[model samples]
Target: MVDQVTSILKEYSVHTDNKMNEIVESRKRVGHLYDMMKYHLGWMDENFNLSRASGGKQLRSTMCLLSCEAISGDFNKALPAAAGLELIHNFSLIHDDIEDGDEKRRHRDTLWKVWGVPQAINTGDAMDVIANIAILSLEDTVKPKVLVSIMKVFNDMVIRLCEGQYLDMDFQTREEVTVDEYIEMISGKTAALIEASTGIGAMIATEDADIIDRFKTFGFKIGIAFQIQDDILGIWGDPATTGKSAKNDIRNKKKSLPVLYAMQTSAEKEELKNLYRKETLTEDDISRIYDILTAAGSLEYTQSMANRYKDEAMSRLEGLYPGSEPMKKLHEIGKFLVERDY
Candidate 1:
């Protein structure tokens, strides 16, 4: 299953990256703006020279294409939308780096850090515009009504992503953030794009509303689980694997699921709160917080929640296309999301 998922990711990544590159290179003559976009995408170096750095897993785009193939057996029809999904995801990442004040992504200096915030914001905005334009490439392939529908879904996803980002930033400043609130924030910030990825792919493949809804729901659940896994990694992941500091979330005081759960349930909740309140946390402070969270079973609780969502996501595929290879691959991908270390 891992090998199958890897093959699917590699196959679709090449397709999606090629499509994205074509879209961006169409305007390469426009100068450093496009270069900045390419840099963030890992296609170019900070100095505008070409380089092949890791961008990410390209999971959303792969899911988009895979969902389309699972339904219609013709993933080619969804290529533009898949590329658009990836570009928009990167757009969010660019802005997110600025918003979070993150210096590095994928072990390299973040776009904001390299080019400064102002130009990075402009580059992100341009990338977003290009993402919209990328989807417009589908106009010649799909019917006008279908194109309009896809546009609506795509735009709604962008709006939700922004709202999620707003809530995430807002939460950072607040003293208390409930688990429910965190879920709501991530639904918009993280899950909306994933939902749209699968939903739009299904839309491109078929006109069946029921199947589309199921795919969207599957995406939403998988996305939730994906974020939970990320939250888990944020604290416990190996820095060599995750490309971030150990206990990075605690260092940043991110009110992730485990921390919130520990705060609510741990006997050491007050001490945890006090530690978080400190302007700076030492190595000892981070270790103590880890102990408190572990003692409260926060990691176990978070992992269970992630698995629950993943299981639900897998359930959505049952009876849709029984025994289909693509359907099986989707299930594998869902499992991988919760189980991935980075």
Candidate 2:
């Protein structure tokens, strides 16, 4: 069903682009700025090849569509919200790579890497503006009162995203990050958009208060599980699916879930502390940190926590809607979010 959803999402992606032009298009005057937005969307690239990695997976858009249908609402009514999440997510990614000094995104050079940080920052800002514009299309698709309420929800989520990013950047230098802190950070940085994707989709579909809360709780829990799983894979999962080895996160001094778990457990917190305290971490030190993190069972611990969240999410989902094909797809995809290496 995820594959089927992905199929619909690709169709929606093209359609969303066409709809966006209705708002963003001006003559050749602002073409360069428009092209920058397109470039980040994988419509244009530095090498000028259309070929790119699976551009964003469109998972959020697909979720919006599915939830809309499942909740007994018209799927087309949710298109603006679907496109909104996609733009919001891509905006976050563009800035995330720039802030992390990451050179690659989806198997291609990140905008910051190819174009430089200053322009990359501007480009991400532009994408965010586009995201806001995308949501306004709801004015046409939804009732006026409903549109205002949903737009407020979308705006609030974006603010939370910034808070998450703020904490993530702060974690870089902080020596005493906890597992709890990691959860909060990901909730803002990674989970907010995801939660909104599912929640807003439900809003477009149904007016039941209980059902909306169900979708919110479900998306929130799954989002945490997804990031924890990603962090674990970043440290110990296979490289082919993850694009980063089990050792990559440590090499970058990332304060991910497992790393935080290991930090407080070891009597040698001092040792772990010293390794990360260095100005420049060597390749050799990264190997040693991985060994310590492994010995501390950080990967296993993180995986266990992911399972707990997935269970919680599934339970909430079970209450909202009964067993059905779409629900099964949601269940499968939700579990896969945590269990899969990629």
lDDT string for model 2 (1-342, tens) is 446545555755665555545545532546366666666777777654553444677777767666776787357777777777888898999998987888888777888877788988887888788788888778876787877878888988999999999999998868788888888899998888878888888888777889888887888899889888888888887888676755777877888988888888976677988998998788788888888888888877898899999999888887555765556556766877887766
Candidate 1 has an lDDT of 0.92
lDDT of each: 0.92, 0.78
Per-residue lDDT of candidate 1, residues 56-153 (tens digit): 88999999998999999988889999999999999999999998888989879999899899999999999999999999999977999999999999
What is the clash count for each candidate, in the order shown? 0, 1
In model 1, residue pairs whose N, Cα or C atoms come closer than 3 Å (at least 3 residues apart or on different chains), thus clashing, are none
